[model samples]
Target: MTDTTEPTALLTAIDLTARDARVRKRHRAELRFRGYGIFSIGVAVAALLWLFTSLAVGGAGAVYTTYIKIDVHLDQTVIDPDATGDAAVFAKASYQSLIRSGLRNHFPGVTGRRDQRALNGLVTLAAPYLLRDIVLDDPALIGTKTGIWILASDEADLIARGKGTKRSTKSRNDGQAAWIAELRSQDRVERRFNWQFFTGGDSREPELAGILVAMIGSVLSLLVCFAVAFPVGVLAAVYLQEFARRTWITTLFEVNINNLAAVPSIIFGLLGLYIFLNVLHLPRSAPLVGGLVLALMTLPTIIIASRAALQSVPESIRDGALAVGASRVQAIFHHVVPIALPGMMTGTILGMARALGETAPLLMIGMVAFIVDVPKSILDPATALPVQIFLWADSPERAFVDKTSAAILVLLGFMVLMNAGAVLIRNRFEVRL
Candidate 1:
C-alpha cells in the first residue's frame, strides 16, 4: 500500500502505442501471412502458364496438316467399270491402283514395287475414302484425270509439320525417306488449314479426326442435364429451407447432401449404370443416360447453393410480405426466389462446368464409344469432348498429341466462356444483401 504510487508510475512509463512490441509482432505476422498468400498464388499461376505453353507449342503444328496435290487418273477399270450409280460398285473398286497410277504419272522415275509402295506412303489410308467420296459426289470424275489435294499419312504429315519422318535415313528401312526427299524437291507437298479436323469425325488416322461430333454430344448432354437438374434442385432446396422443420430426419438428409457433394464422380457413374442403364433400360451411350448421371452429380451442388442463397435473403423481407397479407409461399416465390436466382444460377453454371470436364463418369457409362456420326437426338449414341480427349490422348499416333492439345484449348475456351457467363449473371442479379 505504501509503494502503490511508485509501482503505478513505473507501469505508466511502458509504451502502448503503435510502436509497442505486441503491435510490431502482429504487423510482422500479417506481412508473413500476406507473403505466403502471394507466393501460393504465384505458384498456381506459374503452373498454369507452363501447361498452356507446353500444349500450345506441341499442338501448334496440328492446326494445319500436310497434303499432296496429285493428279489422279480415275481409270474406269480401277473405279467403276459398269458406269452405274451403285454405291456397292464404287465400294468394291480397287481405288489403290488408281492412286498408284496417279503417283506414277507425277514421278515417272519412281519404279519397282518397293519404290512404288514408298511413294504411296505419302497419303493416309483415309485418302482412298476421300477419293471415293469425291467420285461418288460427282460420278463424272470416275473416268477422268482429276487434281485433288489428298491428305498425307501420319508419318508424311509429321515430316511436313517438321516433327519427324519415318523415312529418316536413320531407320533400318529408309526407302520412304528417299521418296519423301524427291517429293519435297518437286513441291508436291503443301500445308493447309485442316478443315476436315473440324468437320470430320474420329478416325484411326489422326489426320482425318475432328471434334464436331463430340461437341454436338456435349451440348445435347448438357441440355438434358440442365433441364432435369435446375428445376428439381431449386425445388428441393426451397422445400428444405422454407417448409421442412428442424427434425432428425431433415438433419440427416442435409448431412447426406453434403456428403454426396464430396463423393467420387466414378461412384455416380456406377449409380447411373445401375439405375438408368440396368434398371430403367435407358440407351447405354445416349446423352440422355449421360445427362441423368450428370444431373445426379450436379443436384447436390445446386441444392446447397440454392439453400445458401435462400438463407441469405433477409428474414425481414419475408416478415414484411407476410405482414402485408401476402402468404408465405407468395413471399418466398415472388421476393426471395428472385433475389436468390442469381446465386442459384452461379452455382448451377459452376456445377455444369465441372460436369463438362468429367471423363471417368462418361467412360463408365459407355460414352467412350467411337461415334463418327453426329448425334441427331438425345437417344443417339454419343461421346462428349472430355471422352474424346481421353480417347485421342490414348492414341499412339503422334498427330493425336496435337489433336489432344487443340481439344484441350477448345475445352478451356468453353470453360472460360461458361465461367464468365456465371460471373455476368451473378453481377447483374445479385442483391446487395
Candidate 2:
C-alpha cells in the first residue's frame, strides 16, 4: 500500500502542538462571536415581548368600571300621579327632583350639608336616563318604592375600584386607621360593571365617556374605505400585472405608487383635511370624509400587493388556458383572479388595519370628539379608537391613565384579529407542495 500520511501530517511533536494551539485560538474567537450574536437577538426579542405585555395589561383596565345599586322609593306621595297623563309634565325637573330626594333614603342617619353633598356623589350622570326609563316603563313607578341602580360619579367609581385612594386627614398612624375605619363602616359603596363607558357621551368626567359613538363612526369610515379602495386598487393591479403593455406610463405609475407608500400618514391626513373637509365641504368628522382619507392612504398597499399576487400566478397556467380556447379575459378572471384573491384579501386587510390605527387624519377631519345620541348616517360627527386614546391620555384625572390603556388594548386586539384573518386567508389560498 502507498504511504497514506499527507505531507502536512509529517510535522514534529512541537510543531504539531503550536499548529493545534493556533487552530483552537481561531475557533474560540469564532464561537464567541456567534454566541454574542445569538445573545443580542434574544435580548431584543425579550424586551419587545415584555413591552407588549405591559401595554395590554394597562389598557384592559380602561374598558371596565364599577358602580353600586340603590333603590329609590318612588311613591304617589312624592310625585303628582295625575301629571303622569301628560308627557310634558311627566318630563319636568320635578320628576328628577324626586330622584335627588331619593338619595336621603340610602343614608338615612347621615347628617350635615357636606355629608349630603358626599351622598350625591354616588349618583351617575346617567341617573337621569335610568330615572326616565323607569318612569316611562310604568307611570305607577312614580309612586312605588322602586329600588333601581343609580350609577356613581367617576371619582366615586375610582375610589371603589381601587384606582383612587382616600387621603387621611391626620399624619398619625392611629388617625389614619380611625379615618379608614370610619369610611369602611359607612358601607354605602358597591361595585358593578361600568356599562356607561360603551353607551354614554364624552364629558369632563370619565364616567360619562362612552365608546358607542366612536364605534359607530369607525364602522362607517371602514365601510367607505372598503368601497373605494378595494375595487380601484385591485383593478389597477390586474391591469398592470396581466394586460398592460410595457410602456413609460405604467413605469411612471409604478414609481408614483412606491413614492406614495413612503409619504408620512399625517401628511395624508392634512391633505384630506384640506381637500375633503375644507374644499369639498364634506361634514367634518363624518365617516365619509375620514374613510376617503384612509382610502387614499390604503390604496398604494393594496395595489402593490395585488400586482404581486397577479404576477405570482404562473404564465404556464395562462398559456394552457389560452390553448384550451379560453379568451385572455376569461383565463385571467377564471384561473388567475381566484388564485390571487387570497393574497388580495390579505393585502386589503393589512391596509385596513393601518387605517384603523390612524389618529392624526381623523383628528384633522373633526373626528377628534363628538357625542352623538346615535350615528344616523355617515355625516354624523365621531371619534375613533386612536383619537379616543389620545384624548384620554391627556386627561388630568389619574383614572384616565387606565382608560388610555384600555383603548390601546382594544385597538391592538382589533389589529391582531385583522392580521390573523389575513393569515387564514393566505393559508387557504396558498398552494401546498
Candidate 3:
C-alpha cells in the first residue's frame, strides 16, 4: 500500500509541472504579440508624420509668387498701332514690345538683340497677356506709364524665392542673375500671396498656373457620382438584404460584389474606356464620364456596406414594426433603413473620397488633357485635381516641383475633409438601439 501511494503521488507531481510549463509558453507568446502590435503602430505613425512634414515643407514656397515691379509704359502706338480705339484692337496689339521696352529702360546698357532677348526672358511669357487685359479693362491706361507688378519668369521667381540653385545657366549667364539681384536691392522684386494660384487656370508658366479648374472638375464629378451611386446602391442593398429570396442568383451577386471590391482600380478605368467612351460615345475628359466610371467603382463598396448595416439591426425591430400593422416594405424602410442610414452615408462618403483621389481611371478616360479653361458645365472637357498633380509632377520645369507638391497638399486636404465628414456622420447619427 505505501509503494502504490508513492508512485501515484510522483505521477501527479509530474503532470502538474508539465501544465505549468505550457501556461508559461502561452503567456510569453501573448507578450510577443502585444509587442509586435505596438511596434507596427509606431512605425505607421512615424511614416505618416514624415509624409505630412515633407509635403508641407516642399509646398510652402508655392503659396507666394515672385513679382518684378516694372514701370510699364502702355504706349498706345505699340498697343493700338492703328489707334482704332477698340478694345479688341488693343487686345491684339504688340504688348510684348511694350514689356521689352520697359525692361530695357529699367536696366540700361542692355543693348544688342541677343542681350535684349535675354533681358526680356526675365519676365514670364504670360506677362504680355496680363498687360493686355489691364489695358482692355480700362483703355484709359493705354498711353500712360504706371508701375505694374509683372510676373517674373519661373527661373527668376525661383531665385527670388531663395531657390537659386535651380536657376538655369541661360538665365544666369545673360546677366539675369545680376539683374534680379539689382531688382531685389532696389525693392523692385518682391514676394506676395499668390491669389492667381487659386483664381486662375492651368498655364505653361508655373507662376500663372492655378488649381481652380481642377477643383471645379473634381466637384462636378463627385456630384454626378453621388447622384447616381447613392440611390442605386442603397436600393440594391435593401432588396438583397430585406426582400430577396435565399437563392443562387442572390448568392452569385454577393460573390460578384465582394470580388469587385478587390478588383484593381485600373480595371475600372479600362472598362470605362471601352463602354463609356467607345460604345456610348460619351465625351472624353468630361466630368460626366469621370463620374460614371467612379460610380461603377464605388457601387460595390456602398452596397456591401449598406447590406452589413441593415444586417446589424435587431430582428425584433422588424417584428415589432410588422406587428404594429406595417407592411413589409414599410417596416424595413421606416424602421430598419432609418437605423442603417448613417452607416450607409458613411460608407458612401468614404467611397467618394476614394473616387476623388483616383487618377488612372480619369486618365484612361482622357482627363489628363492639359485643360487651361475652367469647365462651366459637367459636359465640358476638364481635368481632375489628381490628374493635374500627375501632369505637374512629370513636368521638367524646376518650378513645377513646387506646384506639384502644392497640388498634392490640396488633394490631401480634400481627402482629409471627406474622411472627417464620414467620421462625424457616423458618430452624430448612429443608432445605439
Candidate 4:
C-alpha cells in the first residue's frame, strides 16, 4: 500500500529479543517491584522493633522495686502493751511509729512534726503491713530489734532507680530531699525484683498493685469461651458444608453468618448486655458472662474457617469412603474431619486470641469494675487483662505508666504465645489431603 518494504525493515530493526527495548523496560519494572516488596518487609520489621523497644525501655525498670534496709526497734509497750500476746492488741499497735523511729535513728538531725512527716513520706504505707506480718508470724519479734527491708515510696524509689538527683523535686522539701540524697550517697537504698507485682492483687497504691487477678480472670473467661464455642462452631460448620442441602434456608444462614462476622464487636457487647444480663440475669462482672459474650463473637470466625477448611478437602476422599460402603456421617467423621482438624483448631485459637484482647465486650458485661480481690470462681466479679490495662492507663500516677507498659508487654507476649501455638499445630498436624 505505502512503502511496505521500508516499514517492514524499520519494524525489524527493533528486535523483539531479550535485548529489545520492550524487554529491557519490563526487566527494569520487575526490579522496581522486587525493590518495593523488600522495602515493605523492611518497614514492617522496623515498626515491630520500634514498638518492642519502646515497651521494653519503659517497663523493664518497673519489674523491680527499690528498698531501704532500716533497723526497726519494736517496743513491747507500743506493740504488745502487756505481757500477753493477744491478737487484738498486736493489731491495734502503731507500727508506723516504729518505722518513723527507725527513720529518725537513721537521721537524728531532722526533728519537728513537719520534718518527721516529710521523712516518713520516704517509705510506703505498705511498709507497716510488712512489719505487721513479721510481728504476727512470731509474737517474740514484738520486743526485738530487727533490720527489715521496707519498700521505699514511689518518689524515693524513682530516685533510687536513677530517675534523678535531689534537684528533680520528687521530694516534698529540701530536708527530705537532702535526707534521701544522703541515703543514696550512703548506699542505703537497693533495688530488688518485685515479686509483689505478681503475687498481689490490684491496689490503689501502684507499688502494691499486680495483675494476678486480671490474669486469672482472662484465663477463666477464655476457658469458658473455648468450651462453648469450639464444639458448637465446628459442628455447625460441618453441617453447613458437608450435610446441609443447597436450599434457600441454608443460603440465608450462610449469608447471615457472613454478615455477622462483619458486624462491629461492640454490637456483640450490646447483645450480651441485653440477652445475658437483662433477660437471663447473670451476675455482672462474672467471667461466665464475659465468656458467653466472647463465644458469640468467636462463633462466626470458627464456623467460617472450619467451613473453608472442609471445602478445601477433595470430594474424591468422601466418594472413596462411600465406595467402601461407609455412611456419609462415618466418612466425614473418620476421614474428612480428621484432615481438617488442625486447621479448625488453629482458627479456634486465633479467634480466642482475638477474644482475649477484647475489652469493649467485657466492659459491657461489667468486667471493667475495679476489683481488688482475686476471683475464686467464674461467677465472681472480675476484670480481664485488657480492662486492667485500660484502668491503669487512665490513672494519673507516674508509677502506673510503667505498670501499664508492663501489662501491655505481658498481653503481647500472651498473644504471641497463642499465635505460635497455632503455628505449631498447623505445622505438626495439618493433613495435606
* Top candidate by TM-score: 4
lDDT (tens digit, per residue) of candidate 4 on 308-401: 9898889999999999999999999999999998989999999999999999899899999888899999999988999999999998777777
Runs with alpha carbons beyond 4 Å of true place in candidate 2: 1-60, 81-89, 93-96, 104-116, 138-141, 144-147, 165-188
Between prediction 1 and prediction 4, the one with superior TM-score is 4
Q: lDDT tens string, model 3, 1-433?
A: 9999999999999999998999999999999999999999999999999998888877876778888999989887787777789877887888888888889888888887877777897889988888888787888887899988888887778877666544466544437878888988888998888888888788888888898899999999999999999999999999999999999999999999999988888899999999999999999999999999999999999999999999999999999999999999999989999999999999999999999999988989998999989999999999999999999998878888888888999999999999999999999999889
Best-fitting candidate, scored by lDDT:
3
lDDT of 2 by residue, 160-271 (tens): 5554433311222232233223444665454556676677656676766766776677778888998999999999999988899989998999999989988888888999
Worst 10 residues of 2 by lDDT: 167-176
| Clash count for each candidate, listed in order shown | 0, 9, 0, 0
At residue 37, give the lDDT of candidate 3.
100
TM-scores, in order shown? 0.88, 0.82, 0.89, 0.91
Sorted on TM-score, best first, the list reads 4, 3, 1, 2
Alpha-carbon local distance difference test for all models: 0.85, 0.75, 0.89, 0.87
Q: Once superposed on the true structure, which residue ranges of model 1 sit more than 4 Å away at CA?
A: 1-34, 76-94, 107-115, 135-146, 165-174
Clashes of 2: 9
